[model samples]
Target: MTAPEPTTDGTYRDRIIAVEPGGNEFIADADRHGRPSQLVWTWASPNLEFATIFLGVLAVAYYGMNFWQAAAGILLGAGLGVLAHGVLSARGPRHGVPQMVLGRLPFGFKGNAVPSTLMSITAGVGWFATNSVSGAFALSTLFGIGPLPALVVVVLIQTSLAFFGHNLVQAFERFAFPVLAVIFALASVAILGKSDLGAPAFEDGVGGLGGFLLTVGTTFGYVAGWAPYAADFSRYLPKTVSPVRTGFFAATGLFLACTTLAIVGAASVTIATDATDNPTDAFTSSLPEWLASATLLAIAIGAIAANAINVYSGAMAFVTTGIKLPAHIARALATVFFGVAGFLIAWWALADAAASYEAFLLLIAYWIGPWLGVVFADQYLRRGHRVEGFLYDRSYTNWPGLASFLIGLVVSVLLFCNQERFVGFVVRAVPELGDITFFVGFVLAAGCYLVFCRAKIEAERVAL
Candidate 1:
């Protein structure tokens, strides 16, 4: 989910050590009061994440639109993620802490509990269920087996990879990146040769404003989670790395890759109705004859790599909130617990998700988008470019942050999601609440914090 700065200052033994791409050193022990280097730059090339979610040609099938419209929708989504992640990740490295830890500054000690627990639950259960279903569905495309067996296989693979944490996940990514490229490249070539896209219809059949906003809203809804980890990865960089470069390398790379992949997936679906509800079918269609099974393996591995990060991040969030368990144990228990729950969810509610995955994606957006908005705005605008001990100090309490975070979460869930239907029978639902819900959370959190800070000033004056 993130990186840590390598501890070289000979300070605390408790720092999280991490190395950056340009050989930058980072020590994730901001409070080098006692701990040594727990910080580490354990791995590299974080594998075009945050953006890749939108890139599968299989997604294109839902709208059945031409390449241009799909590309536009993906681009809009990528822009939102890239901007959010770029600013947010840079802040975490300077603070030498994870995003959720940083979140404590705005949400207060107990206030952060809700967001952290929610995120942990979602990442653990939601990601596991979705990935399990996708992987199983992919295998079904090849083996002609029923969906149940595929789900079991996917769960087993996910559980195994999660045991190793980010080390194995990053290594798998590095190992598999080339294969993904080769297969995708080959498929692109074949697809291009077979059909001339001619000119794509962007606004065609969109009819009016409703269709346009719907498309934008859908993409934004799915991309909500990727924004939260900006700090998780950025917290490892040397305090000196230009935020511009950090944002570009990490956020831009993720977004660009995602948009490209989504276009390809959309293209795949537009071209072939044989496309499975899962996008891996896109790969199988273009894999060279000699390497048929390799496609399936890559998807399985890809799912594992993704879910590994998800499990790790979710565990960190949950443990931080619980504030009792050590990181290792917290990660372990949360990983298993969420995995099991998510598997059950998949077994029942997710049986038909492939057909209505977009709806669920929108519900995620309802929650994740507003949360990201509040966190990112608070870190950059309110913190004034410095993260200090006061953020974690017990005395400060951050009542405003706590109040605002809670209020915003409630608004997004109750107003944006439940107003229609939060979770449909197949997937989470989004019945089009408009953009106001997104901004409302940020404004409410910020406003509440300002009010609380002002009230505290008044109370102290009156006492004096």
Candidate 2:
């Protein structure tokens, strides 16, 4: 099957076979055919992988929640997080720009770099490393190879897929989904059937209102981290696609996959006598040899799926930061640069996976919460207005957005951050409040932006 060529009129479906290897410059139109339903598999497939499972283990092993309690937290937190994801995704077809680029509307062309740069690091380096370590460990377990060798293998595959760019990434996700679903479904049954669902909630005197709230926050962070990149995948769909349908499919896919697998992780902890020391091994150890090997392979593939998005979006974020380069070259180079940086971080993370993973999730929530609040607030203020002209408009800069975002971020971290690395003053004083950094940051940023910038935003819209 020959691949479709880029249209002379500049409207084309992304090539499934050819290397896309370009930044978001042109808007996709009706000629670029895709359904809202494809968003489901595109979002769901990568998340169905093992890193999500590790989230559940974090709740049960570290946060000290019981199987049932952790499950509830996972469901509630993931549902809320993915809802944001869906909303952001629906913007893709409307703008036909990368998520970070669309951020230019709210942040201004120059001010957009702040969030774009942060997202580039978080997605490309932070998440890339986090997911890579998990994939590397799975490879090591399967082949008895050293972690470094397995990591090299994992990074190579992930970067290559991302380097090929959008269409291939979408294709890979669609292809991987059914296989991942089946394997995880089987693994879930094997793990959950033997789990002690009624296990003590306070195994080491860790169960309390604080623990439960922490579990919810951590889970929310894990899932909500994807909000920034939500529109990257959906931008190729025709603009006429129903926003409601697009958001629904994306949210449903993410919520179901993350919740179900996370619950499986929680349940695995209850049954595994050795305890959840190494989440990767603990998860597979209970299954039969054939199933275990298959699960490990699925996890490695799943990591690739997830990392592909990370690398691609990281490149988009990098380019969106006012860097002037040929779109294809810039995106490809950014992919390699971030992939190398992520590999180094992955090497460091392997030394202390659990601690690093926990800290990473919390750290993500700290920044992303404020970022989301500002972005969503900006969207609501616009009321479905299109600002494609400002996407690349270097002269535009919204100081209010930047100021509001910083205010929200600072307030949230100072008051509600509750991580092992750094406990906030408020959390220290009132231990029961747990980590509400995400909630505080989001609300504060949105409120501040609305209060301080609404009139200005309205005037700008009228001018446009």
The whole-model lDDT of each prediction reads 0.54, 0.85
Candidate 1: tens digits of C-alpha lDDT, residues 418-446: 22344222113433333334445556655
| Residue lDDT tens for model 2, 1-464 | 11121221343356676666456675536436688999888888989888899888888877788888898889888987998998998888877777888788778878888999999999999999999999998999999898899999999999998988888889899999999999999999999888899987656734677777778888899889998898888877888889899889988888888998888888887774665445587789989999999999899989999999998899889988988887558888889899999999999999888889888898898898899899989988988564656666678788899988999999999989997778888999998887889999999999999988899878877777
Best by lDDT: 2
- Native-to-model Cα distance after best TM-score fit, residue 253 in candidate 1, in Å: 2.8
Task: Give stretches of model 2 more than 4 Å off.
Answer: 1-12, 275-277
TM-score of each: 0.75, 0.95
